[model samples]
Target: MRDLYSFIIWILSYQIITGQDPPREQYNISCHKVRETCMQDPSKSVPRCIENYMRRCSMIRTRTPVEGYYTRDMSDSRPMLETEEGIIVHISSEALQKSRTKEKMNSNLIVSLVNKTFFVTNSSPEVVYGDNVLGVWLGVKEISNLSEPVQLRFINSNQNENVSCVYWHLDQNGNGYWSTEGCSTNVTNNEFVCSCNHISFFAVLINPKIPEEIHIVRLNYISYVGSALSIVFTATVVIMFLCQRKKHSENSIIIHAQLAGSLFLLHVLFLCSVWFSDRSDQVCTTLGLLLHWCLLATFSWTAIEGFHLYLLLVRVFNIYFKRYMLKISLVAWGVPTVTVMICGIIGKYTSVYGKYAIHEEKEKSSNTSICWITTQTVISYITVNGYLGLVMLFNTVMLAVVLVKMHKLRSQDVQIKLNKKRLWKDWVSLLGLCCVLGVPWSLAFFTRVPLNLPVLYMFTVLNSFQGVFLFLWFLTLTCKARKEEFVPSKGTLNVSFQSTEEHITTNVVSNMIQKK
Candidate 1:
């Protein structure tokens, strides 16, 4: 009895040390014989018999299956066990053969490993019609234990040819959480390989990068700073125009004030929406619509400025337009509102704004966002760019015509010939006017070229400071005119007053003499 006990202990120790289980038949026979011996012998302990049975059953449970074949379909219903060796996948030969006969060649295989089950798919696998079945190799490197191998079977669904073999395991959140940051994938022959350094629930992903996530961080910073400055300067311009209302009652000042007010609202709403877009979709959409309206209004006002300038400087004789301000206000505000309403209605049924593909790469793509006109929709192109294009063209034509007229006037006018300094000053003033009126928007034509960065920088800087430039131009003109009117020479002032009084006295005396 002592020798038998020692022998059993030694055998158990040997199995543990080798990490191997005894043969299934041998284990079953030993349990059966032990039960029979305990039954026959009255001295045999009932507890000992039960212990031996449990020990043999455990050995049977841990044993690796001799048959290595598996099919993805069988994994759904089959009982599975997780072991130190890895998750054991077992499929009968008949089941695998039957699965291959199905019409869809592409099918996802579920592989149970440790506490996780992974979905894997093969690139391309041949379908066999008959009983001659070939085993597919599936290699899974368990996140917990890297040494052991887990096998799985897959069918290629042909859903996406560019699907990566690697899958990211995700945690359950309100929305399913998944990422491919650390996962690796490889394919060889009939084998699908997936490996990860850490453990999680994993699955295959197609086109994994979300558009909102692309370049959002960087763009947010640029937009915030630019918009903030624009807001400040635009507000300043509006305030200046309001404070100096009595001094400068020209239509030009009123137009500038309107433009400045519109720009101020645009920048404020843009800054708010860009920063807090994720809080509520409705808010973002509303802001986007408002921005669209303001943007159109701004360009419309710029075009009106050009038209007003054309009448003032070019056709100086017929400078009067009946209710010109009212006409311009209707066109500037009404057009954008109508266009925005139409766009908003159309956008309700379709995607008008969101991420878009700016460029494509072999393995990836670059994407950009247009919050108001999210996508590159036809309506967006026509309404936004088309409208802006027409405005820009009109402004450009007016600018050219004004410049030509100024050149002819400078050559022919007696006043201009007498003062070359005035010619130089007029050129400077014209340049300043062009900057304030968005002539730099023409640089948008060069934005697609290789030198786009510089052009974009110049465009951004000039447009952002447009309010500042307009304000400075107003200040300079006001100061210069005021100085000319009030700051006169002492001698010139005395001579002018004496001449005016003498002429009045002579006219009164001559009238009295004629009456006598």
Candidate 2:
């Protein structure tokens, strides 16, 4: 029992870092059967942990080999060597493959360790300057062991030539993959230098034989872009709000500012949860769903305003501000609140509702490292997006009708004999703002149907810019002090009351005169 416990503990500690059992020869007596033996031990935590790690790791490392055992020194750290001409970064294949185990490791797992040494002169550029910088890379392909071709792309931020730095295929053995031009290339000019700053790259293993080939796999680059845009958009909205504050009505200004601030906060929260924490947590998952709901609600409220104006102007209905004030509040606050709660509950019980691809990444992609929601069932994902699309569709149609009505009214009023046309101007401008901001964001609910980076980026860019239009037309274009010309007939009411009082007084005086 003691021996079993000790073995379980040892495996747990080792798996925590390298994330897998390396070579069977290193353990000698077969650590694969350790779980079976350790299950009989007094405690179950350590053995269970080992089992979980192995299950998760095996799903990811199917094609990629474990490092260290096949390549570089694994003693303490990798070696460092320097040269006057350029930098030398050495990574052995054996060490890499040795550490590749059947355990779930972090994306931050250093797949390859390098001995880097630079000895450039002081006057030389930073890329060539003397500094021993470790170049760490993830997902190094076992090029020598694969049949079809593979690529090892370098970081090319400058958009220079030599874009195809590494490309290779099997010679004949059908047992290996190789890099054609080795690893490093010398650059002549500073303009075309390859560095980690501006460019990011990935490797692709093409044409895997038969049923095991992983296709349609995507990376979490969308999450990266979404998060980045969220930050930038948040900042832009904040600046615009500050600049345009004096031009708006107090109520409209407050609501617009709150909307901007809320969006900024929501995105920031998402950014942190995405890049820093796990999306599987109850809090993070709920918050992520809430952010989306908030975005939908924001546009939904704007559409409501447009529809309300259309009813008042075209249908000739009284714009009783009191009657619809509560409705506006309900649509703005109630809908999103309910949605977020429902999503949270679903995420808690089933894996479908709040599992945003930004945070809840799959343990095993079964192919490429794609970051998407792996629901307990696929139908649930379809259902959620379907519902969102429908809601957005309804709002879009309603607003479109409102805009058309406003245009027609404007054309009709233009021909009529009126002085200022103030009503026409204000109402039309409001409708225009609604169309501009709400249309693009509404389009996003459908565009993200296929779920990809390009679409995601396109949507993000559009949605982010919506804040600008929102501030410009809705919040910054109107003045708070100006009263509308359409106030009820106060002068007519007062005159009628006075006339009735005078008639009563005259009747009383005539009665006295008759009595006299």
Candidate 3:
């Protein structure tokens, strides 16, 4: 036992001293494999498979001219050029000597650059800037974490671009993504430089702007906590609803179940977003589409709730669609699915969904990442924010009309006595109804960039655990329904849905509560 423990401790210490990941191997440039992957149609394969290309890469034809470069002298610098003068890599003499001595390398060094001219990056999280990638290889003895760093100087073509140095990092499946690990960037008016402890494919990527307010950080924490709580509560609601489905299979009950179902899915997808985004590949895109569909479906159901209210309150004489539940379910679920599919197809060419970086004001680099629609894309505005605005408009109008009618009916009625206790209950009912129809979603518009701390906090708190409130509403209405005296009417939904103005004015909330 002592021997086993001692060996485990030794291995752990060795791993920590050498770093968690294995040392970087000398990256060999395979022109044939790269050209084959890059030449394929992007639509025919995973977008990542054809992301980057090698310029001036040529087959070993007897007639073809030389394309790549090689060197042995440690002091000599190399310029990778196809037509215009491209990137210039300056290897420090001290670093090269150190590497050669460490690896016992007597062989020549190889260098090349891959630029954005042929390397498409529309599928990537970060936008590729004008700076090209610098690749270095020494004969197969691998070396990493050099005591001396290698410096790559970049020509600043677009000085206005907010940029950072990144290296191509491959995952377990050999899929490549950009990372800033083991590297640093220095920018000047005319040129920028990337200094890395190890050599790999390096480039500059444009950084996206993110909400910088300190409260935004707090809101993120609130969102995560709220979503987690909602997940637990929503699962409980869903289980309960399913258990009582047969007993309460009315139109209003059906709508409540559907709304609960959508919210449950939306919250779950939102909470697991970061895990999907870490794939830094296709999984992130797929997760983004699913999340967008869930959000839209929730919105669609809220609007349907308003429509149900209109049928019950305004058109009291008759409330029948030939197949009410079926038709509404088709609309609520189908519309969002179609819309998100279209966006996903478009995203295969443009960056519509994937991992998004969040920037902090106090730092020069992105400090956080999440899976979401890219804010820079116009689709985010038209399909998400704009869609929410329309839903909010429709739901707001319906809520207003219901309130007005309730007040008018109450004023004309003489049977019901107004009391403080009754008023408080009415307020609670209205708040619960807001949760059911997602009226608090209007807070999303106010929570946009340049976010107000108070409003943002309120929005997160109210919307995050929406399922808890929804479940309470369900429980309260169920209890109230059971408490009433039993009377089975012979009339159809049309007659039962309607009430004389006198009865409706007795209690607006009682009239609007879901039918069991």
Candidate 4:
């Protein structure tokens, strides 16, 4: 017992130091003799029995090939043997050495055979000795060798069933490193089967492709352009509200200003922090937290807008609340701050932001390194997207109620006369209001279909231009209302208020009630 323990410890130490797997136990059997028995009870004894038979089979090895040997035609003269198992072509020492060197550098090597390129990736080159000759296991994908009888070379060893193969090609920019754009791979015992539509050089890359890097360039372009435009228009809206503070003091105006402010900050901070996410971890984290707060605040403000609209139309006479803006500010800002703080605490204890890879069999995946919530973990999803989803659902319900109220009001005002131009203006104003007040965001639920790209694009476009829509609506409404006069009563002189559609509705309602 003592000797066995000592030998086991020494073997483990040797394996650790040498960075090699433990030697496999050799078994011998004849597959030809046990073929019928193995076939009959495949699930029970076939795999084990076949593995033993493979262990006993003699490994064939070939000598090193010269430099020009790859392009040579050995179809007629090369020795060929057929067996019930499979065709096995031994590799030469020179080829094995070259493959090993290339594998060490990139782990993705290219071999040109008969004017065709084959990619070598996923599996490493394994050295094997047979009949005093040296060889290596070389997994190659034939890109344009469909018509030719391709030879596969491998080193006889204990094959692992869990090994997977992936297809690889050279990077699009000629960066030397290969990419897995159009290639897919399958594994069978010790061999890799690669498939691709187009004829090109392919390889089995050991490193999986980073999913985030795939479309980052295009995404960055969209974000930069969208954020810049959003900032410009949002700033304009803020300035307009500030300049005309005394003119419009309604709850709706106040809520709109706050929502625009939050959106402005969100866009600005996103632009600044996203580009520098890789440089400083602390800065990225800080910006990420601020961005999260701004996002939540924006949603909160939108919800507030919905609430205000609901009160204005539904409970116009009954609406009464002390310090409305102050209370709303607390809910809008405090909730997000609390949420972000909790997320921050959780992140400190566990990883919530960083590079993550999602593997799904047939779906396009994302691998990203960013200072944002990762969807890879359940906690992150529940805290981030889940929370936002609830907010969106509430806002959507509010939007429906607001729309119904607006429609009813329009129907009640059917006696009012308007030209074609005025009618067009009203339609535009309504559309703009809907966009700025989070109606487009509600459409996000419709983006889960098979053709989601277009819906997502529309959402991004509409949401990014929210500031522009708000600015246009403000300018149009204010300019038109400035030309009209609001006479409150006979004794009171003409009082000019910066009029909005909501104020117009209130004035009409008060007049009707007084007349009654």
Error of 2 at 481 (Å): 8.3
TM-score for each of the candidates: 0.51, 0.40, 0.55, 0.58
403 in model 2: Cα distance from truth in Å? Answer: 4.1
- Candidate 3's TM-score reads 0.55
Give Cα-based local distance difference scores for all models: 0.50, 0.38, 0.62, 0.51
Q: Model 2, range 420-463, lDDT digits (tens) per residue? A: 56456546554544533355555544432323335545565555
Per-residue lDDT of model 1, residues 1-516, tens digit only: 999977786777454223344334334442223333434543323222322333343112224332322223333455232323233333333323333434443222332221111111111111111112121222121233323323332333443322332332222211112334454555444433444433333344433322234334444456567678778877887887787676656677788788788778777766665555555667667777887888888887878777776665556447778998888899988999998898888778965543223222112333232346664446766877787788788888877765675565455546545777966766666776685566876775555443445565666666655666666776666565456466642212211111111222222333335445
Looking at candidate 4, the ten consecutive residues that score lowest on lDDT are 126-135
Task: Give lDDT for model 4.
Answer: 0.51
lDDT of 3 by residue, 380-457 (tens): 777777888888888788778767876764565433336556456556666766887788888876643333446668
Clashing pairs in 1: 106-155, 106-156, 106-157, 107-155, 169-201, 169-202, 353-374, 353-375, 354-374
Relative to the true structure, candidate 4 has a C-alpha RMSD (angstroms) of 14.1
